[model samples]
Target: NEQISKYAVQDPELEGMGTTCVVVMLKEKEVFFAHAGDSRLYLLRNGKLAPLTKDHSRVQEMIEKGEITPQEVLSHPERSLITRALGMENVLEPEIGQSFEAGNGDKLLLCSDGLYNMLSNSILEQILTENAAAQDKAIRLVQRAKDAGGYDNISVQVIEFQFKEQKIILPTTPLNFFEKNIDESSENISPTIPKVVKEKKIVDEEKVPKSEVKNTFQPKPEMSEKTPPAVKTGKKVPDIALIVLLVLFGVVLTLFFLGSGMTKDPKPSELNISQTPDTNAVAEPMNEEPLDNQQETTAITTPKKDEKPVTKPEKPKKIPKDTLISYTVQAGDNLRKIAQRFNMKTETLKKLNRLDDNEIKTDQKLKIKVRTVHTVAAGDVLSRIADQYKTNRELIKKANDMTDNATKRGTKLIIPLAKAE
Candidate 1:
C-alpha cells in the first residue's frame, strides 16, 4: 500500500486507480495461483464446484466462520466495500496457493467480485458442463452478471482442460555446454507423458494420439536452445592417446643418449692404404735410354710400405648417473633459499621448470642435480660406501681409483649418485 500510494501521488494516470491481480500458471497436471483483493478462483471437477481462492473482503471472512448467513451477505449494505486493494496506504499480505492436479473435465474459473456477486455455483456449473468453450463461456458469464444489473465493470476467464488437448511438459534443468553434451551421449531418452486439456484447438489436433499407445514416437524438441543440445562424451579418449604417444617419444630420446659412447670406434675403411691414395705425389719422367727403358722396367716404387694402424683408446663405458641432492621442505623455504641451499643459481631452478620467474610454493618438490664428491672416513670402507649408496662395491672402487677395492681414510672420491628410490 505504501508503494501504491506513492505511485498514485507521483503518477498522473494512476492517480486514483487500483486493481486486484490474479495469475495462474499451468504446468503439466498442476496449477499454481497468486491473487490479491476480492477476485476469486473456482474449480469445477466432476460435478462439484469448489472455491480455490479466498476473497480478501471482511464480509466473506465473517460468512466463512458462520458469523453471517449467505443470504445476509448477498444483500448486505457493506458488501461492496473492499478492505484491500493496490492503492491502499498499507497493503495486507497476499495469498499464494499450492498446485493441484486438474482432472480431464475440470473447469477453472477466475473472475472479479463484480461477476461473482451476482451469480452462484449452480449458474456457473451448468454453463461449464454444457461443453461451452472457455472464451465463449467467459463472455456469457460476464454478460449474465451485467444482465442482472452489475453496478461495476465485470471480468471473467474460464479455462477448461479437455483430454484431447492434453500436453505434459517434463521438468527440465539448465545445463552448461559440457553437461548437455554428456547427457545426449547416453542411450536412454526419457519420454514425455501426455497432458490433459479440455478445449482442443484445431492446430493441436496432431498432438492427440500421444495419449494412446498407437503413436508412442512423438517428435521431441531439440536439446539446443533451438533445442537443448545433447552432450558429447567421445572426445576424451583421443586426448589420452596423444599423451601416451608424447611419453613414448620422450623415452626414445632418453634411450638415444644411452648409446652415445658405443659409436666412438673408427671404421676399418679409414685405415686402408690403397683406398687412401696420396694426391700430392708428382711423377717425373725417368732419364733413361730407350733400349734400357725397354730392357727392364725396373721401376723402383720407393718405400711403398704398410703403415701400422694406430688405435685410439676408448673412454670407459660407465653409465652416467646424475647425482641426487634433495632438500627437505622447511618453513620459510622460498625459491631463493632452496637455490642457495644447493649453491645453485636461482635462474637454473626457474629454467628447469620453464617458469618465467623464480616462484616456488611451500611443500613443492625441487630437484637439485650436482657433482657428488665425498671423503672417506674411518668407518667407511668400499663395501660400506657401496651399501650406503645402494650400489655394488666395484663401482665405488672404480670411482675412487682404488685398484684393490681398498681405500685409505680421508681419500676423496667422485661418486656418481642418484636419488633414492
Candidate 2:
C-alpha cells in the first residue's frame, strides 16, 4: 500500500516523508520493544501468538475502537500513514516497550505493516506453529509479503530466546562502589570516596570466564536517580594540583617577608660610603665588627642607619566593591573555559545568565556571575555533568526547567549549582 499524508496532518517542510521503525531489547528471558509510527511487534509463546504494541496511526486506532474491520483497514486511503515521529516534537514521549517473559522455546517477531497488511492472522499463526527457526521464519515472512505484492519498505526481526548455562558473579558492595566511582569520575575525587573496592572470595577468579568479569553497568534512560560507574584511567585530579600550588605560593611569601626583617640596620663604616671613597673602603671592610649582644643602654632609635629598610606595599583601595561582574566573549569562547579561569563551574555561570548552552558567538557579552551556561559534550550524562559542577542532577533539572534527563550532543545547558561539599 502507498503511504499518503493528508494536507491537514502534514508538516509544511516535510509533508510527504514517512517511514517505519521496529527495535527490540532482550534481557534474558524477558523482551522489550519500543516503537513509533506504524511499526508492529508480535510474540509467539507457548503455541499462542499476540500483538504487543499498538500502531500509532488512524487506522489502527479505529480498529481498536471497533470502528473498522480488518478487511476495511487493508484498503483505507490512510492505511499506511504515520501519526507520530521521533524528531517531530519539542517534547518526545516515546511509547515504552512492554516487557514479557519468554518460555524456553519462545519466538518474537518484529515487522513493518507491509508483511501483516496482506497476510491474515490465521495464515501467520500456521507458519509460526511449524517450529521454524528465527532465520526461516523471517525469510518466510519476507517471501509472503513479496508474493502478495510488496507495496512499501519491508523489514522484520525474528528473535528466539533459549536457556543457556552461564556463570554469574555477584559484587560485594554494589551501591558503595557505584557511588564512589560516580564521585571520582568527575573533576576531582573527594577524600570520602573510597580508593579501592573490597575483595570477595565467593566467585573464584580462575573459574570465571574473562568475558564474564564486567565491572561496569549501563544506566537506563528512564532512571533519574541511578548513575553509571566512572571508568578509572589513573589520571591526577585538579584539587591535588591546587593544593600543591597553594603550598608553594605560601613558602615563597614567607621567605620574602622574613628576609626583609634582618635588613633593618647597616654597619657604620658601610653606611659612610662617601667619606672613605678609596683607601678606607678596603681597610674599613676588614675593621668592621659584629654587633655586641649585651649593652648597658639599649638602642631604641627608630632610624638605625642612613639606609631605610624595605616595607610591604599597601593594597589598592580606590576601587570600591564591585557592583557587577562582567565578561566579554572572545573568539572561540565557551562557558566551560571561562568558568574554569574564574574558579567557578559552568552550571554556576549558566544560572547567572539564564542560558542553556555555551552557544555564545564572538564579541558576545556574558554575565560571568549573574548567569551560567554549559554546553553538553560527548561522554556527558546528567549525573556526571552535575557532579563536575559540584551539584546533584535534581538542581540542574530545576534550573534548566527540564524534567526529562535526555540531553543531546552539543546541546547548551545551564549550570546554577554551587559547591555542595
Candidate 3:
C-alpha cells in the first residue's frame, strides 16, 4: 500500500495527481481500511454512527499534538488542509486498521470530506438506516452533499451486509417412490436436514437376516373312515348320561348353598369377625442392614467437611526495572518538550531525574528511562534486535553506551521505545 503512494510521489507525471485515498477491504465480516488525507470512512452499526478512519489533516495533527481541541477542528481555517497524502512527498504513511468487526445490518460508508463537512454524523446515520439499496444510498448521499452547498468533489461508497436464513426442504415424495437413491443409508446424511425414511423392501436382502421372518400357515391330514370308533363313541352314552345327572344334582345343591350364603345378608357376628391369621404362613421381609454399607460408601466418595485440601499461593508478577540512559539536550529542548518527544509524562521525568523544574540548558546530559534491556546472544545483530523490539539501531546504541559500530556477541543493550530528538 505504501509502495504505490511512494511511486506516485516520485513520478513526475503524477505531479497533479496528489489526492486523498481511502481503500477498504472486507474479509469474513471484518472491515479493514487504509486512509490518507481528509477522506473518511464511517460505520453505521447497531444504530450508531462511528468514524473508522481519521483524516491526515492539519487540524487532526493539532488535535494529536494537544495544540488544539477536537471541537475547534470543525471551524479551523486549516481543517481542509491535509498534512499527509499520496504524491505529496517521497514517502507516505497512511493510517490503516482492522479493529472493526462488521456483521449483518452493518453499513460501511466511504466518502470524501465534502459529505462529512456538510452533514452531521446523526444525519448520516439516519440516511444510512433508511430502508434503501446501497447504490441508491450512495447516490442520495452524494446528492445531499451537493445540496448542502458542497463545491468540493463529492464521492460516496456504501456497503451494507445482511444475513440470510438457511432452510433444507425435503422432496415431497415417499421413501419407496424414490427407489433409485434408497440403496444409500439414511443415517449418514445431516441430522439437521429432513430426510425420507427408506421402506423395508428397499433394504438389500443380504443386509437383512432370514431368521427374523416366520411362516404361520400349515397343512393337516384329513380324518379317514377306516379309523372307526376311536373311543366306542355313543355306546356308553347311557351310563355317561346317568353319571352326568348325578353330577348335575350335586352342582345344583352346591349352587343352592352358595345362593343361600349370599342371601343371608352377612350376619352381624360374621361381619364383625376378622380373618384368622394362620400360624404356618410366612412372608418375606426387607432387610435394612445395608444402610450402614451405603453410608460407608458415601463417606468414601465425599470429602470431609472439616478437612480442606491446601492450595499454594501464586507468586506475584515482578515489575521490570527501566534502564537508565543519558540524553544529550538539544536546541529548544526543555524537560516538558523532551518528555513529550519520548511519549512520557513530564512529572515522571522530573521525579526520575530529580529535576526541580522544566528548565534545562542545551548540551546538558539528562537521565531518561528506557523501558527494556536485552542481552545479545549467538547470531544476534543490531538490525535484527531492533526489528525484534520495534526500535532503531541508533537508539539501541545510544541506550547501550556504544559508538556507531556493530555490536559484538554477548553485548547487552537497552531498547528505548522513545528517545529525545
Candidate 4:
C-alpha cells in the first residue's frame, strides 16, 4: 500500500486507481497467503470445500453485525464496495492468513470477486472437485463466470498437490569360499578344487582304519615327465613370438625416423641454393626468368589513353515499416519495465496503451508498436545497417539498447523508423 500510494502521489491521474490483491505462495506442503478486498482463496480436500479467506467489504461487515444474512450478499448493492484495497490509503492493513498444511490429492483455488459473484459457492466446489487437470478447471471456472454475467474481469488459478513415491532395492547375499568352490566344481571337478583341500582329505583318509576308509575319493592318473616338457614348450612359444614382434617394430621405427631425416635434410639445402646465387649456377637462371616475364605482362595489359570507364547505377533498398502487436501486462510489470523490454520509450508505451499516467494492472492487454527487426549477419555493422535503412546510427543503437558498436551475428535488433506520413 505504501508503494502504491507513492506512485499515486507522483501521478495525480492515478489518485483513485486501485485494485484488490491476493497473493498465495506454495512451499513444499504448506500454503501461505495474504489479501485485501473481496478476492478469495478456497481449499478442496476429500470432496469438501472450505474458504481460506474472508472478504473485507461493506457487505461482510453488515453480515458480521447481524444486519444481513449470507444469502442476501448476492443481491446486496453494497457487496462490491470494498472497505480495504491497495493504493486507497498511504498506510493500509491487509489480512495475512496463517500457513496451512497441504496434502496429496488436495486442490486450492484463488480467484477475484468477478468469479464468485457470477458463480455460487456450490458451483465452485463442484468445479474444484472435478476429475480434470488444473488448467482445465481454471478455464471452466472462468468460462462459467463469463457465461453467467461477467460484468467485471474474471481471473482464477487452480493448483493440485501430488507427491511421488520412491523405491528402495536391497542387495543379495554373497557365497562362502567352500560353497563357491563346490558350486564351480559341480560343472568341472579337477581344475576347481584347491590343492590344500585335496591334501587334507587324503591325510584324513590315511588316519581312518583300513576297513572304514571305503575309497570314497578317487585320484586322477599322474602326468608323465614328457608332458611337463611339452607344457613348458607351449609357454615358451608366445615368448619367442613376442621377441620377434619387438625386433620387427624396432626396425619399422628406425626406418620411419631415417625417412623423416632424409626429407628434412633437403629443405635446408634447397633454401641455401635459392638464397646464395653463387652457390648454384642452375638456380640463378630459374630466379631471373620470372622477373623478365613479369615486365612483359605489365607492358601488354596497360589501358589505352582514349578508353572510357563504365559505371553501373546502384539500386534502392526497401525500408521495412513498423508493425503493431498486442502485449498482455504480467505480474510485477510497470510501464517503464515493459517499454525497456521492447526497446521503446515509456511515453511511447503509454501512448500505445492510451493511458494518461503510468498505471497498469496484471492481465491488462495493451497495444505495442513494434519496430522493424533486423538480424545481424556476417560483416553487418551498426553504421552500415543505418545507412541501408536511411536512419541515424545512434538511433539504431538506442532502439536496440546497445551499449557498444559491437554486434554479433544472428542477433535480432529493433530498427526505429520515422512515423509514416
Candidate 5:
C-alpha cells in the first residue's frame, strides 16, 4: 500500500478528484473484501443478510460514537461527508475487511452508498430472498433504487458461488520415449512363470468346451479417458510347452554325462602308458662330452721323466702329553726355522700357530704349553734328535731352534713343542 501511494495520484492539477465509496471482493472458500469511504459488502445466507465491510463516512462515525441515533442518520447533513476516499492525496489507507466463510449457493452483494440510501433494509432483504439468479437479483436491486428517486450514481454487483469436485484427465496417446524404454525392459524379463495373454480380445467363457483346457484372458472392449492401460502379456501356450521340453532335455543330458564318466577298475598290465622311463629312449643326455680330455688331464699331472711324486711333509708326533713352551721369534727366522728351533714339524708348527705361510717376524712370542725340554748334544743332528725322541726330523729341528739343516752343541730346545689345543 505504501509503495502504491508513493507512485499514485501523480496529477496535482486535479482537485477534489476523489470517490465517496469503493468496494472490492475476491471469491474463494474464504471471501475477501476491501473498502475505503462509504461502500458496502453484504453476504446473503439462509435468507439473512450480513455486512462484511463497514462505511467510513461521517454519519457512520457519529452513529458509532453515539453522537447521533440510527434514526437520525438518514436525514443527517453529515451523511454525505465521507472520511476516506481514493485519489484524494498521494497515499491511501483502505480498510482490509475481515474474511467470511463462503460455500455453495452463497451470494455476495456489493453496492455503493447511493443504492443503499434510496432503499430500506427490508426491501433489500426481500429482493435478495427471491428465487432468482445473481444477475436477476442485481438488476432488480439497482432498478428498485433508481425507481425510488436515486439522485446519486448507483452501482451493484452480485455473485452466486458453487463448489464441485475437480479432476484432471491425462491424454491417451502412444507411449513416449522414456515409457517405451521401460516397457521394452519389462517385456525382455524372462521369469519362469511369465504371465501370458490369450489370442482372443473377448472371451465368451460359457461357450468354451468342457473337454478342452484353455488359459483364457479378457481385454477391454473399448478405450476411454478413465480406462487403465492394457497389460502386455507374453507368448501364450507355446512358452509353457517350450519350458517343459527344455527341462526334460537338461535332465537327460545330465544323466548321459554321469553314465559316460563311470568305468570298472583295471590291472597294471592293462594300463595305457606308451613307454617306461627305464628304456634308453628317455635316459641319454642331449649334451654329453667325450672322455679323452679327462684322460689327458691325468697324463699332464703325472710329470714324466726324473720328476718325483711330491708328497706332503708329515706332521711330528704329539707333544709329550699336552705340555707346551713359549718361544720368542728371533732375527732371520721363518716358520720352518721356528719349528726346527722348537723341535716340531714345520707343518705342525704352522698349524699350531695358525700361520698363513712359513713367514715369521722377529721378537714375536709364540705360546706352547711346555710338557718336556731337550738339550742338543755335541754329536746330535736334528734327525738323530727326532729318532731318539720317536719324533720327525722337523720336530728335532724345531726343538733344537735350528732355522736350517744345522746343529749346534749345547743348544736348549723345546722338544716337540705343541700349542694349546
Candidate 6:
C-alpha cells in the first residue's frame, strides 16, 4: 500500500484507480492463497466444487450480517462495491487463506468477480466438473461469462494438481524344502546348529560295535590274574665315558687359549705397502700451456652475454559475470514466482524491475540474471549439479523454476551464479 500511495503521489492519474488481487500457490500436497476485493479462489475435488476464499465486498458483508442471502449476492445493488482492494487505501490488508491439503486430480480455479458475477455456483461447478483440460475449462468459463452479460472484465486462471501413484511391494516368502531341493532329514535340523554336532553324531554311529548296538550295555576290560608283571631296576650307574670326554674337551680348550695368547702381533713397520702410491718414486713432467691459450679455452666455453633468459608465458584469466535475459510472464506468474525462476530474492527482482510492490501482469516482460545454461544429463540431480557449479540446491531449483528435486534428462536449465563481492 505504501508503494501504491507513492505511485499515486507521483502520478495523479493513478489516484483512486485500484484493482482486485488473488494469488494461489501450489505445492506437492498443499494449496495456499491470498486475495483482496472480489476476485476469488475455488477448488474442485471428486466432482465437488468448494469455495476457498470469501470476497471483501459489500454484498458479502450483508450476507454475513443476515441482511441478505448468498443467492441474492449476484443481484444485490451494491454487489460490486468492494470493502477492500489494492490501492483503495494507503494501507492494504489482503486475506491470507489457510493452506489446505491437496490431492490427485484436484482442479483449482482463480477468477475475477466478472466471472462469478455472471455465472452462478452451480454453473461454475458444472463447467469445472467436466472432463476437460484446465485451459479448456478456463476458456469455457470466460466464454460463458461473456455470453451471460460481459458487464466487466473477465480473467480466469485454472491449475490442475497431478500426483504420481505409489506402488506397494509385498515381502516374499521363503521357498519350501521340496522347492529348495533340501534333504528331509536336514529340514528338521535348525540352520543355526554347528556342523561339528552332525559330524560327531556320524562318527559315534560308525564306531558303535555290532554287539553293543544290539545290546544297551557294555562291559569294562580287565587284566588276567595269571599274567606276569614286569619290574624296573632300582640301581643307578655313573656315565664314565661322558666324564672322560668332558675332561679331554676342557684340556684341549685350555691349550687352545694358551697358544692364542702366546702368538705375537705384527709391528706397523713390517706391514706390506705394495699398492700404496710411493712418494719416493720419480714424478713425470708435462708440457705447460701458455696463459693466453688457457684464457682462450675459457672464453670458448663461456656463453654470450647478449643471450636473453627464457621465461614461460602467462595465461589470461577469465572472470565470471552475471548475464541478463528477458522473461515473459505467463499465466499464474507473479513477482515472487519470477524471482524464484531466476534464482534471485524477491527484493532483488523488484529492484531490477523497479517494482514498488509484488503486483505483476500477464505477458509482462521481466529481466532475469543468468550465469550460464546447463543441459541436464542422465543421473543428474539438483544437489550434484549445484555442487558441480559451486552453488546450492535451492538456488538451482529457483533458477529453473522447479518445485521438487527431480530433474528431467536433456532439459535445459538456467544456472544463476551469485555476484562476486
Error of 5 at 81 (Å): 0.2
TM-score, predicted candidate 5 vs. hidden true structure: 0.36
lDDT of 5 by residue, 188-297 (tens): 64432122311111111222111111112111122235434323333133777567556644533443453345322211111111110110011223233322222222
| lDDT tens per residue, model 4, 1-421 | 5566678558744534567777666554566666766777777777766677777665666666566676566554334456566765434456666777676567788888777656666677788876666777788788787666454667787877654332212223232322556765667533222222111111111121111111122222232442221112121226775665566445334433433343211211111000000100111222232321334344345557897655578876566555443454555678888676565778978875678998776545565554455555546677887787676667666544466677654344555554421
Write down the TM-score of every candidate. 0.37, 0.35, 0.37, 0.39, 0.36, 0.38
Q: TM-score for candidate 4, please give it.
A: 0.39
TM-score of 6: 0.38
Worst ten in a row by lDDT for model 5: 272-281
Model 2 residue runs over 4 Å out of place are 1-18, 64-66, 164-421
Better of 1 and 2 by lDDT: 1
Please list the C-alpha lDDT of all candidates, in the order they appear: 0.48, 0.47, 0.52, 0.54, 0.49, 0.54
For residues 165-193, could you state the per-residue lDDT of candidate 3 as single tens digits?
32222234332332456568565544221
At residue 166, what lDDT does model 6 achieve?
A: 32
Across 33-95, the per-residue lDDT of candidate 2 in tens digits comes to 556566777777666556766676655555654656655654443343344544322122345
lDDT of 1 by residue, 1-421 (tens): 4466677558643443457655566654466665666777777777666677666554564565455565565444334434345553232334556667665667788888666656666777777676545666777777677566554456777777654333433223232322456666654432221122112121211221111111112222122444223344332337765665566445333333432332211221111000001112122223433321335456544444585555689874333334433232334567776554444567776665455766554323345543443444445556766665456665444433345755543334444333222
Candidate 3 overall lDDT versus native: 0.52
Among the numbered candidates, top TM-score falls to 4
Which segments of model 4 are wrong by more than 4 Å? 165-421
Runs of candidate 5 with Cα error greater than 4 angstroms are 1-13, 20-27, 164-421
Clashes per candidate (backbone, < 3 Å): 19, 18, 0, 0, 20, 0
Superposed Cα deviation of residue 122, candidate 5 (Å): 1.8
